[model samples]
Target: MTTWMHPEIGDWEARGRRVAASGPTLGDVDVFVVDAPARTSEELEPLVVVHGFPTSSFDFAHLVDQLSDRRRVVLVDLPGFGLSDKPDAPYRVAGSADAVASVCDQLGLRRFALLSHDMGDTVVGELLARQLDGDWDVDVTRRVVTNGSIYIEMAHLTDGQLMLLSMPDERAARGPGPELLAASLVATLAPAHADVDMSAHAELQCHLGGDRLLPRIIRYIEERRADEARFTGAIEAHPSDLHVVWGPEDPIAVAAMADRLVAARPDATLTWIEGAGHYPQLEEPRSYLEALRAAIG
Candidate 1:
């Protein structure tokens, strides 16, 4: 594994000055927490955000700042991804969810609203299951936003993703070089907008480190496939108080997927953001933030 200087990571660390950098154990995993101080009364509940695969809490940098001003915002870098310590164990969705709950407990948050995107949605589903199954006492006040994940069938995953599932070690050998990983991350966006330089962000450099831990990361992803039946079952059993805000042009989680989520949770509201792709939060921050505020309110 090669270590390279990632200015993006540095910038994110600096921006997260309000966030205490430390590892807290959650069910044997040392999970990393990036928190913005509570602007509201401590008596008020906090809003916890979870990022999906291949990305970290850094995904919520902008939203966290906005939300933190009015509410306590907690973002977590799931084990093995970000600055969190990666252990030599299999990573599963249930484990990830439990880890999230553990973080909430350690932080003394009694109840929270959830915001998740991409693979984080899967973890969120598991968290809901834990709540329903009586493993955790956390109350999910509301579900604010979702993005280029959910409805697993809709993932327009690349050949590399499918290949990763098949050959973990070989894929890891490909190396998640900063430039290669940065380019792969950039490809997820629409090409028309020159203003959106996804690569210019420092957080991208930190997450591209997945290239080095590709095998373990692939194992974590493939584990989700096995849990699909269970995850789907859980989603069906305990329907979410969800609000879906998706980019219609998203190649990964299409509008139809958001439709399916709405269909599953009929009470939930789904909105399609026009002319945006996978990363709506990054692609359309203003619109996304507006939709989020409305959803949570």
Candidate 2:
């Protein structure tokens, strides 16, 4: 295992790519990239992965080996989450998409495929929109959108989320507390997935934001609703190959949201990961990776 990963994470971190270079992304925001040195195959385009809220690039840690087997993998801790800088700013989908682009540029990526989960899926939508606008700044070859509330009207968020959001913004300053933060993170995934350990995830919450940035991070939920049209519209009218691999059992995103995405973009191929949860990539790593291999191909 590489020294970059926590000791608690152990050998799982050794499963695949090692960090080539990791540091602050554009705007001096810290973002780590677990990458393999140099190119393995020129035929394979790099894969840029953007993680959702409340979780960092670590969520995809388990799938890094499979994802990078052929292509170089770039995992980012979106601003306000993970190992990235959590500035007290409104974290919007569009902004995150731009950050992803900046990360690609900083890493010297000219073209890539994208896979995003939860709110991160919306960031993929922003990139789709940018592609639709003919922005040559970042070239995205394919996109795989997974469990997310991209369609606000179509999502079924949890009461825990509502309660957390309802708590005054100051609660983050007072601290959301480990238990509260831990519970909210677990609730989004399938309750049956007891095998999915979240101890590291919970620990990440407290340390990632100095235990006082939840309120600022929670603002992404509002941004999701506000940017619905622009983001979803791009998905509906996507420019490149599109795929939607969803866990029908996800409580928050729900399978219906996947259906809507596929329907809107009839060109999108939908892969169903049965008995999985919101974090399908984590819940069913093998199936998710196979689906991604097909999607990206």
Candidate 3:
């Protein structure tokens, strides 16, 4: 099937692409899986990656290529984001995880390393809970958590995020449009990196809802608050090894979040990228790649 995919994501040569089922009631969307060049006899576990808010698989365009040479990496454009089907429904974060699971099932993936960033971190937590409960079909051998607003109370939310989370219909109806989203995305990066442009990616993301998806997408913030116990508890009680790589300069997912993660998961490894912002993978790709490699190493 000719599945949906954003042209600007620069993954035209992705190993494979397909539209997979998201959930019982939720619909289907495009899922991309890329295979690294086979190298060693001892192959590592394939990695099932989940992306976070406002953006799509495009957010990991560079990082995906960087890691693809080591092991297979799976990327999906969650519903209502990226080049997937925008069904004008509430874009719940947990639903994104479900979509990833469906994608995994399609690939016959049973045991793989799980890595997530931003809102995707929450999705990973949900998968962790399911794995612990023996409900999921696959095994999450290891997990990686990057910068995210896990502890919402401690996060210093961006004006655009706060704006979207407020006033519901009115804000999304007439709130920050594509321009603001582009600006907000740029602002979330390290100021020192002026050459890192996010407009191309941000513009495509803004097209997901024509300024209407913000209200629907903002439902994730509510989920983070309401499902805190289930998500965080699962994170703390997670059986396999857990790794956290944070961008300390991020105003939203700040140092406090990294600190809190370590406090809860004392055994988890934590790596801090000092000058990077919210999107550390983009702001500091080298450091992000190093930390990520170490996680699955």
Candidate 4:
């Protein structure tokens, strides 16, 4: 429940734009929400972005300003992540999609575009399926963008990712302390990028100490594995305009997965960003933003 109103975030808030939290009550969980409006009257179509595991809406902090001016950008922290409540239950990809669709319903959003990354891509695929099946009553616009994560051929997981997937009690047994674990989680995102400084490390520590960390990671892993079938099903049912963007340097998801994704959705385009690692949005913001602009437009 800690809200960082730093100068950087404050500047965006000062733009006379609006940001409000809407709790889309989905069963027992309440998904955390943030929405920013378009600057112009004609550019108000809502665009929703979902963050992956270990990260929250905070992941989109760097890109939100740019997108908010042109569209009502919605960033959500799925259950067990960010400022959301972590219920004592199994987390599945379909559950995450249901929560997202609930958020869309609460916001009264119709005909929206989706941008998802890492684990979020899995959730996006599930949500797409629900829409296609007429289970979720939201009109998803044809534009969809997925970056840095594809589950179709993701057969391998990095050591750090594996470690996170290990049971929380097992992770607790490793004894790195909450601070170290959080630092490690952030480190895994970009090993080649500049080292996370002490202050950043402290911030991560606080984030991990929050009640949401362990459950979020656990649910993220569990849901990812459980929803494999649904994910592929969604790909098979994907509309023609879907786009996949990946970082060529990402070790977790190799370029080969892109081939599988493209093969499944022959109409989808795959763009690989050079010199970027797993978190291309953070590692290569300009390039990521350019690619996103093209994909969404």
Q: Which candidate should be chosen as best, given TM-score against the real structure?
A: 3
Positional deviation of residue 216's Cα in model 1 after best superposition, in angstroms:
2.2
Give candidate 2's TM-score.
Answer: 0.86
Better of 1 and 3 by TM-score: 3
Best candidate, lDDT: 3
Indicate whether candidate 2 or candidate 4 has the larger lDDT: 2
Q: List the residue pairs that clash in candidate 2.
A: none
Clashing pairs in 4: none
Q: 180-216, model 1: which lDDT tens digit per residue? A: 5556666665554425655433234244444556555
Q: Provide the lowest-lDDT 10-residue window in model 3.
A: 33-42
In model 4, which regions exceed 4 Å deviation? 1-26, 143-149, 168-178, 189-192, 196-216
Q: TM per model?
A: 0.85, 0.86, 0.89, 0.81
How high is the CA lDDT of each candidate model? 0.66, 0.71, 0.75, 0.63
lDDT string for model 3 (1-297, tens) is: 333334544544354455656675366655444434424433778887788887777788776666766577777766767666666666676677778778788778898898888888888888888888887877778888888888878878877777667755432555366666778788877788646777756665666463567678767778889998888788778888989899888878888888898898899999998689888888888888999888896
Greater-TM-score candidate between 3 and 4 = 3
Q: Model 4 RMSD to the real structure?
A: 4.1
